[model samples]
Target: MPTSDVVVVMVPFVAQGHLNQLLHLSRLISTYNIPIHFISTTTHCRQARDRLHGWHAHDNFIKFHPLHDPDFTSPNPEPNTTTQFPTHLQPSFNSSLHLRHPVADIIRSLAKTSRRVVVVHDSIMSYVVQDVKFIQNAETYIFRALSVFYILCFNLIRLGKELPFTLEMKLRLPDATATVSQEFTEFLKLQYSHQTFHVGNIYDSSRVIEGKFLEYVEKDEIMGKRHWAVGPFNPVEISPDVSSSAQQDRHACLKWLDKQPEKSVIYVSFGTTTTFLECQIRELALGLEKSEQRFLWVLRDADKGDVFKKDTVRRLELPEGFECRIEGRGLVVREWAPQPEILGHFSVGGFMSHCGWNSCMEAMTGGVAIIAWPGHSDQPHNACLLVDVLGVGLLMREWACRDELVTSVMVETMVRKLMGAGEGVEIRKRATELGGELRRSLGEGGGGRKELDSLISYITR
Candidate 1:
């Protein structure tokens, strides 16, 4: 089949982290002139297109297909990237359970064109897509947006292999309490609760990234399935002109960064999906206030939408007198701040992050040290790799496995250790060096590009 006739259909979870990684993967694959059909919720499709600055020119080579919610009959049917999306209606968009039919239709249509179609969907969709073996000239691949470390651990859990219980011990078992949500609880349970590999079912293949730039662990002998390491799919450079409704926050963040000393500020965020209890939120606020370091904090309110209208933002309350205490040294923004844009800033020295794989990859690309504060999912494992294996991150000690309400003192100590002069110096140096290595490994003849090319060849051959 001709390269032009080879189409890759990519489906990402509705959340930002999954969508961002898969969107970049779409970019990498489309560079070879092969067409891509990226499936996402209508709101998320517009979100992707808006953030994807250069791809406006790739109209013919790429397409963003929207997945609709048939049950949304209350009259507000527009797309939403942030809190504009009603809380009750969000599950319909986030899960593959609802997307199964639409995705199947996409596969069937592509098969009819006689084009070689490869369906690359988020790992959560495994059970639903596993049975989609009837399409002609179509292959399904599971795109694990997490790291090899996380994937290996998950596979072990599924096989009931004994695992060392360390940090994130809550997720070590199925019945452990969750800080995330009921929806995430289901996603967390799906992998271990079922036997994932079924002959002629499940997936034809799975893909992962080289975590902390380490060697890939051989898994075929254990799982009886092939896994491809094709990433560090995080883009080396992010365009600053990407459009978003939160333009004011972006401008304020950049303008504020301009006034700070180089490498003197830490960027703190827990991502869009990670849930935080009221006390955890209070502890973080008090900790940053006590750290005495210049910082930018992304704080979102748990009870309401991110925005009330234009010019107003909603977020949980901070410690009383919090702003005045850190007057010259802190700036807080509600809702999603432009993470890539912030991380790329030279004045930004380190990140206090949830250690989500996408956030890890982005921080590495920008060459910043991380203070791994994992909250949920495979994040704790990713944090383990960052701090223990890669030597680029420091653990908060208090944020390990559960909703442990870390006190202000604990938060202050970790923040100070991360940003102040001392052991963090070596970690910062290593992080910078590793960042360079990751960037080089994805450039022109880099391993990631080569692996992607090989994947395309295999699917079409």
Candidate 2:
């Protein structure tokens, strides 16, 4: 067992992807018997706990410290906006800054009892832990909740390093025009500046897929801060009881998957933050109907300004009779669905996704082939990795075409190409092979395991 004298504190950004990554990492660290205090807003802490699985038995080792931000406002959805990014989330992002003082206080209190207080904060959440440097026994590490490929490319571009890759293919750095608000832009700048204080970096990536990119991160003078690639932070195996009774009851889609043929269903989801216009939703529905493939689709509105607010009776609607037309062949879930469980299902062969990093890691680790429909931010880079570098996915549409309404015919063609037997057969084979490698990396002798062990030793020693 690792030393109990060392306590780790986790601070994550409020986004679902960022929170989930840190929560999983906390679970992994708890296995070493290191106490972890996870700091977040009360709502976000609830969000993490609700979604947490595979580590229920280790709950004692992890303590959730919910900070109340009285001034924070919930996001109100703007239905007519053409922006592909989740600009509605700006309020929540801004509210997260209010956590700085309370988070610092928690760190100071933990530092009093522990010989070492190692803080693992999200890359975007550096402001919350900036005061840790003054706490003599405390040190911070920036935990990148993104692919190494995206991080290294973003860092290289920031340093004006000429690369073989084009700007469109890389993860773009935040700029004044890039964000919806000036406050958000300044918050992003603060996040970038605080990185210099971190003692090291930790990435939710694996050497199996990003070996070369990991090397690039290590050699970069500005970013080479003793990093560790201990990821696919999510569990490798799907737990039978991943969700609570209520969630399982809501997820009838899983029960539906069990009845399908092996490698036949195409799991379709755009993640929590993506919201589509009625026209786009209609086009997507038409394409799925025309493709004549078995599919499970998670349909939900883009997050509201306030995530915890009661759902409005107004919900995004599909074309009339769309569900009836594809009755047995398609399942459209309006509530939250267990993505990792669905992707890990034997019946799920391909994923039609928005190519979020968390979704990419889940799909890659599950060995499910991807139909990439990238939206904005790091998604385009993640799509590039999945479709170009990994050769385990096919691109449906690019971010450049996001404003243009993708016709039903175009969607039908991409769906057919990914689910059909021609090129998809090769893609599936590669995905399966890659999934095996990723899962192995989480096992005894794998690179992820080695790096995780190294991280524990580095902190506990």
Instruction: Give me the candidate number with maximum lDDT.
Output: 2
Please, what are the lDDT tens digits per residue for candidate 2 over residues 389-413?
8999998865556678888999899
Clashing pairs in 1: 301-315, 301-316
Clashing pairs in 2: 74-305, 74-306, 75-304, 75-305, 75-306, 76-305
Model 1 error, position 225 (Å): 4.7
Residue 442 local lDDT, model 2: 88
lDDT at residue 275 of model 2 (Cα atoms): 75
lDDT of 2: 0.83
Best by TM-score: 2
Model 1 lDDT tens row, 21-131: 778788777877778898866766766655543234255767878877334312222222221213432444444466777788877877777567777777766655554
Please give the TM-score that candidate 1 achieves against the real structure.
0.80
Clashes (candidate 2)? 6
